[model samples]
Target chain A: MAVSDRSASHLGEAVGLSDEQLIEMYRLVALTRALDERMWVLNRAGRIPFVISGQGHEGAQVAITWPLRKQHDWVAPFYRSIATCLTFGMSPRDILTAQYATANDPSSGGRQMPGHYGSREHNLVSVSSPVATQLLHAIGIALAAKVRGTDQVAMTFMGEGSSNQGDVHEGLNFAAIHKLPFVFVVENNGYAISVPSAKELAVEDVASRAGGYGMPGLVVDGSDVLECYRVATEAVDRARSGGGPTLIEAKVTRLTAHSSDDQQTKYRSEEELASEKARDPLPRFRAQLVDAGILTDHVEQRLGADIKAVVDDATQYAESQPDPDPSTAMRWVYAEEWPSEAPPPWGFGTAGGHAEEH
Target chain B: MPAKTFIEAIREGMADEMRHDGSIIVLGEDVGKKGGVFLATDGLWAEFGDDRVIDTPLTESQIIGTSIGAAINGLRPVAEIQFADFIHPAFNQLVSEAARLRYRSNNGYSCPMVVRAPYGGGVHGALYHSQSVEAFFTHVPGLKVVIPSTPYDAKGLLRSSIRDDDPVLFFEHKKMYRSVRGEVPDGEYAVPLGRAAVTRAGTQLTVIGYGLMAHYALEAAERVADDGISAEVIDLRTLRPLDKESVLDSVRKTGKCLVVYEDNRFGGYGAEVAAIVAEEAFDYLDGPVTRMAGPDVPGVLQPRPRGLVHDQPGEDRRRDPD
Candidate 1:
């Protein structure tokens, strides 16, 4: 629990995670990373259509997702939140199946363009391709929770460039004004597509705008899983207690291109990419565990082997799954009819004639 | 029962809904202290206080977007956009967010909200103040578009929209705000969305329209009736969840159709009605469907008297020959 504490602890005390929990977190992160890598491979092979890698974001994602009560609280995640989704109990099979656009994909049933996954059971709203759209949606969900007198809070994830969107500002303003229970997590990986963060805004930190909205802003080392867990826990707790929204800026690194279609070398120099690789969050956390004696080389090797087996099985299962039926494309466009007087028009059923010509 | 103009009926409807449901709130620019630019939300600020009848900043996006959030949060919000032309800034929120929320969420939730704006061109309000944007919203599913031609339907349909579980784009014709008047009952009444009202039944031609164009159609129907031609006038109260049954029934009975709308002829709501008539009741048609609409050219600023003349009938003739 020393890692959960706010005070800084040396690498010695941090490695005391129960062996089981450490292995579980590490395995989940590894599966998420592997799933993303395999997705890129599929994209290259033209087997799958699109891919957005969650590389270098595993630590913060795993840490932030650990404390939240899935199926109770809501998550409005961005496209880059694969690791976060994995930590939130989405099976590796589910992620890979969705990537492969298979029928068994629980999130969207292969209907949505890949990566726009959502599950009502898990309280995760479907992700849209429009950047920063989820910010307002999260605020709206939190506001609904507030009005319904529920203790539930919503967490909205976005990137550094999304901070420049008007919807983001409007969302934060509304959340602050209404004191809605929610948190804004900006996974600042330094670049939005080809544009660098410096070219997007005057402020270096996206969290700095929280003050303008009369909310608390915290900047945390995104590579440090312990720091992420502690900050996210405090923020979620505050929101649940009706202390309003908190803006958390997670300083992570984007180890892969924005998407499989992107080439990071065009925008970032080789030296910068090399430095970022050196600070890769997974290896850093692993080193910390080793230095603390919480994990020995033997245990680490076994954990890796277990993770590989799980990911391999999931990938194979997903690859073998059947693609969705083309006719089912129109299914999720609207909800099924409820018992209301005027139910949604599901299919093309024309109403009987009652027209008058004037 | 009492005679009231379209604007008065709208005001009465908001006041009644506010009195009936504590959760109902009205917010927009100049909607509170100023009683709205068109006075459609008049006198309610005094009764509901500042919280329920709020005057928001001059941000259309926030006005409509916040209303969506508020609506989802159990508050029945009626957001006024001052004029229909100014709604472009908030168009994304309406189309992408509000319209899709219920559909995308699989009906787990709904946005019970109304965006009220005065539309049409007869008032000589020129470019920004007048434009029929209903076509834009009508194309978007999960949104109910309502345009009332009289006081009674305005009051009844506005009430229904407030209680309904879908986002409604309520277009109030600026020209008919005071020009159109009818008896609206004092007691609570709800005119269901998607149901058209037959203002006058005839046999020669089925004249179809809504809002200000409905009034014109009524007038034209009367003139045609004087000439020994029977005209059935149908007021399409809601555009999206269109009263297709009523429309097809009228077109079938009359065997002829004339659709009128104030928006440009190209890709207007009238085009949708024409397509439906051709597809569903084509065999019964006696003549080709005709449409009367505004000019395709962008509105120009006219000097005094010329501007006043633009507000008058026959000033700017319909660009379409039909």
Candidate 2:
């Protein structure tokens, strides 16, 4: 059987997921795309500062995120993972609130810049402007889990350009040497800002470098949701089962500019951009659902309408939310209590006495 | 109590902490098997096994970064950087991640780990191996900087650092690893983080210092004592949360103060101490606060530079009855 046929059958066999879960994943992907598009519009309207669109890579993100045990398995995601955050249970309102630097945003309480979302409850690390830094953090988390004898694994996401950074090499080497449970997913979307991957990396396949680190490497079609899910599931399972780390290279296409500040037309030719647009992941995944008799044209149309409504409501709610208080900017610089000088829980000690002196 | 070298006290502190808390682990280059290049972690691998006493690859960034994650995930990790100068590769991890994690996470997470490096000159290790980089970390807010002058303080303060719920940069003087010995308690004990100890009391001048420089300051104080000038010596065990009260108290009583440090004279920790005195106790000063520091440009790159050695600045030199 073909790989798509196998994936379709596997999706049908997976237990505990009702039609609602599948529909929710699809709806989340749609909402993320719409929100990203709206942010681009807002950027033009001077209502938002910046945006990094997650247009084409939504299918693979939604697929992998649907089965994740959020907040349990740590996520060290790259900058282009807005959809992954949403599918993993962050509300659209929260993402929008954070984008607008509102107080209601749980990701950072408006402390961080847009696209640098992190939630303690979600176990999603704060994304930084520096690429590939999260890879080392993921490796560190995985090592901690291994040391603590926890079965949980850390999953790190990155773009193709990040694979060239020294942090990535060190992260993978450390994880592989210690046999730590972790998965590194590289979203290869053909361009890093303006420079093509071919110019940036000597190796055509980023996953092939996994062999040097003594780990299994796999490449899959990122546009196919089911295919991406299957590959990611296998890698995650291998890690959870004590088989060590896996490097997954997801072949994706960038359907938009790198970010609001970027203009892809300046670097990519018109023909190249047109070809990538034609292979957009959303429609391809919907067609696969239709081929499996699980979804029809009417269902897709209804899903699109439902997601658009949700996105509209969330955007309005986010825009209406209050901005963060200026005085609270330095509130979290240190924990409320110093480690050595934490007050007694039951009020046992003298209020201002020097305990260390006695 | 037993007399112990600074290196041995550090090893004992780690062993004691590891024995007490299962969550505490050690990792560094040659820390295990080799027992560390300075033997500060000697016998730890044999005692705690390979799992707890880990020997990491020569990647300083990974060593420091992973320790941050480990500490955040409910493990107390003590990471050694081998030498102070080599910590540059891991500077970003320390400054950005470890130092800022608690602040950025709004107390939801913390990096309660210790980064121990043998710092300062006098061992002839030269450029890469010998450096006093405490000032760099002292400038960082969330990180607590500690420099111990003796074995007792080294062990007790290290134990405190391992238990600290914040990132601490612990500097162990390489020259003092064997040369400096002191009575350290056999039982479990800890030295408070932000307190200074007065090694000696005098009436004329207060000699304020830390790490190996504290020992030098004491030697200079004793030399001055023979000339009948009473010099008070204060050892600042903790650089951050600097026992400013104790420093100010000594400076207030003596009316004259001399801050000494081995770091380069330009922008050194002595400047910070001087700034504090100038800011807090400017009216109490009888004369200008003197500072003795290593000269700029790596101090001539050779020992005993002719005419390079200088005495403490100001008019107090003539007051001695030598």
Candidate 3:
């Protein structure tokens, strides 16, 4: 994971991204990190019950979404896809609303647990707690796009651990057979909770298994924002052109323990911990920008202050929002008034009295 | 109006809807070219072609999981699980994903899809094929469970389920696919959900059942009628949001109850029916509520299902309604 300190800004230039766009990319990565840090603080203060973080995954998450069409393509993100959601047009206010679980939280109106990112407005499918269940959903989106003959591509993510799930196999196989317009990303952040990748997957790389499904499997340096973006653009183009699905395994580092609940010391030794911390992508991207002369001391200071203010305001706004109405607890289980002509949604109105009708 | 078999009515319902709305798609194992294992989806592939009528790989989870995603994107999907027995593999997808989609999204999203599976036993198809699985899904609140006993009801209910903007589990009894026939209107009709159909009238006892058991209850009701005892039969078309008032009303008038099902007796669907009778209509004086269901075994054995239909306690003497 050695990031070249030399002028690595040329990476984005090769992909025709401007210096301003590259700076914005670093800003989003920093924003996701800052928002993640705020959630951890809220969880520890007993203000929020739980937290699922995207601290170390911001690089790949942000860059992969940069290549897709906003609001047109679909995203079926995993629980730790904060940067992806934000990069896909979800604001910090929206994310914080879900964390505080207010009635206005667009994800589920306080119904779903926080970090399970989804928004119909952004074409993000609702997430299921069960691992790998969203993979088929992403494929289904791609199937609909293909059926309608639309040039829309769908992207979905999974952890290295859930990659072993049956739905992954079924989804990848189906997408390949149909040559679906899809990009299946495995954010290989080294562990599935307490289980490391070695135990979860027998193979070294998750992308290697893609060959079995007759698709190209590419392993990228997830911390390299420009490199990740380049690979995603290629996949998205191939999907739109009907070249079929691609598996991109981005090897990321889990900067924190799995979640707030997990203890890092229980599983990893001090030496292994130091190794993961050294590969933190946020600082690498920041230094990469500085070396390329795109980021100056004054500009970096202003950016830092701006990000902090946004997070603080979003936090205050969400905390002030009211909890959902208690009376609405039973609402939305079934559509109370779905259009139906058949006897108009009956309720055994006649009951025993109906015996005389015949 | 023309008389149609149960299987024919189901196909016509899907076909009729597909013609009007271009968003509906049907996908499952062997459903396309093979026309479904029981010919329930026969002639649909030719009409809709490959894009609409898709034959998927042998993956049950994807069949349902894919439908859930498709439904969210505005393409109403009707996914078929070949048999109710094979549905266990996709249990997480249906219950965790499809059923909870709308609720979890707080109505921001709706999974307008139908999971059609053939359930129930009586066809000499032993263990694997014969199972009554309505009780499992009926417990799920967000889902609507519809089981039609007649051809007319099947066509009508199928139309309603497809149009309804929520996840529905439409379990058609495999035994009635060909054996049962009824007059289906030439055009469109829908049987409203969450209502009970009283197939026969009586006062001696209330016989509550659904699917194939409801048909069997009618025959059993006629048998007791010869002895000057009337047995009212209630066919619960929709099981989840049960037609409770109908069940209670029949039990209150008859003063006795017999809850029947082909599934296991211990904690089966009939147990809930009997519980409803004992809870709501308790004031009506009569003998104890009865349940005639299959034993709590793995599946149906030969002679077990047929004998279960006629197997009733000696109760020709009418109960007192006080």
Candidate 4:
């Protein structure tokens, strides 16, 4: 369990992962990348509204979620967590439906902007557009878990830039104080929108802030899935054992610009972008599987083809799904028959005539 | 029925609900041991213990944010923001997370939480302590803003808000907490949301108001009754999805409307009431829809005479047609 930096080793074997599970991880990473690519095309062709790619971070996103119990554990994900959501059981069609803003979108039914993920079936909490707000939500759910005396642990992910938000500090401090079962993971991709990590964080490691809340802080190389899986497993175990929260910073690389409208050329230098591309986790992880003899060029070709087919099918299915009816705009604002006391002249008589006995 | 103060009514209502429903919890600064700044949550910590009546850190965002999470996880959380003015720190949590949780999640999740804060400016508590923030929350579509003027209404409305499916911003007027008293029902009951109560009935002019202004409107109705002017007072219990039918009916009967609020006159909740009346009941109106509200300035910081900061709705009734 030595933390190796970007080098391929037999660490995946040491983690006791089966060959099928490891390959599935690679497939998910590739599928997430391919789906993100499809979204860019859809956005460019005016078929979709927006696209926020999780490029170069899929390895960390999917790997860190390996040790958790899907549909039992809770995840409060940030916008760029497509791979993580996929690992948590969000269908590809769900992501595509959200991208197309169709009626069948599992998360929001075309209500919110793309990249916002939510799925109750998988225990994934609704993620809003505001940065770092998920940290507090994760803590709150964990608080519920603690109050109920359950071993369920909730995890939240944020960007390096979000670490500077007041919510991150307040949530982490509150979680630590209550000894809540939670994990705060920071995907340090070296940039927040256009601001670099240097400007966003005063300390070198985002995990260093964990000490302020009396939590264990660990930094893992985001490109190495094995290292992230190992750390995430430990953090989850510690939280379930009543050890409180742990702050883990996965140092990752962002291959693409922030969103569809952003252009890295404006703020990020070409050399820096090129260097990050060279260390892209997709190819690096693929190389690791190849060196481990678990994957050959032929298996890689088949996985790539299968992922492309899945993405294509999802794109076509979501694109054909009908858009939400404009008349249903006020559907979820309140529950059905809510504000139970209807305005007068339309009701039996007075406003309180039929007050519910609850 | 028990005659109780507005704050006592609130505490009793929540305690009663918590007794029946194990999921209901109160969390905020001083909500536990200190029993809240104004004791609005008095005896709750002792009854429900620290777990149910939590004492959170002195941060508005943490209280609101955590409440949203708790609400989503099968718990009905009532978060108390110390004062209305201090709610700004949690604006993002309310508007983004709590308010929109249901709509964004497409009914997959809902934040059934109530954020209770004391509002209004009568005790000369100054800018930060005494301010009305209902106008800001009323503009958000997914949120329900409730202001109860009497002890009875406070208990009923708060109980109803706790059972509501959407996020509710309950603004308890600071001046009315102890000053306003009435008989609250002893048995289980809830005042339904999205309805207005006609506190005082009349026929000449319909005076629509909420919170402290509603009390002032009732006084104005009584004073105008001394004259030949029959002033009908409508207490708007819920601000959003505003009991429009009640308002339009009152306006149609009275043929005139006067909307009153404690917030600033410019871009205040009263303006919306006036606009709705003007748009829907314009043909029935005998005169223009008048509005009585606080001046369009930041809340007063210095000590002032009895009613300098807030509008005197009863005095404004003097301008009624002779």
Clashing residue pairs found in predicted model 4: none
Give lDDT: candidate 3, residue B46: 95
Clashing pairs in 3: none
What are the DockQ scores of the candidates, in order? 0.29, 0.36, 0.46, 0.41
TM-score of chain B of each: 0.93, 0.94, 0.93, 0.95
**Tens-digit lDDT string for candidate 1 (A1-358):** 1223332235423533354566566666777777788788879998889988889888888877776787778787888888888777677787888788787676667756778776656777767577887777677668667766768888988889988888787678878877889999999998888898889879989889999998999999999887887899889999999899999999999999988888889989999999898757888777766775556677767767777887789879988998877755544333334422233442124543222111
Estimated TM-score for each candidate: 0.85, 0.90, 0.94, 0.93
TM-score of chain A of 4: 0.92
Better of 2 and 4 by TM-score: 4
Could you tell me which 10 consecutive residues in candidate 2 chain B have the lowest summed lDDT? B313-322
**Chain A of candidate 1: what's the TM-score?**
0.89
- Report the C-alpha lDDT of model 4 over A186-251, residue by residue, as the tens digit: 999998889988887788998888998899999999999878888999999999999999999999
Q: What is the DockQ of candidate 3?
A: 0.46
- Candidate number achieving the greatest DockQ relative to the actual structure: 3
Ranking by DockQ: 3, 4, 2, 1
Residue B9 error, candidate 4, Å: 0.6
Supply candidate 1's per-residue lDDT for B127: 74
lDDT of 2: 0.80
**Better candidate by lDDT, 2 or 3:** 3
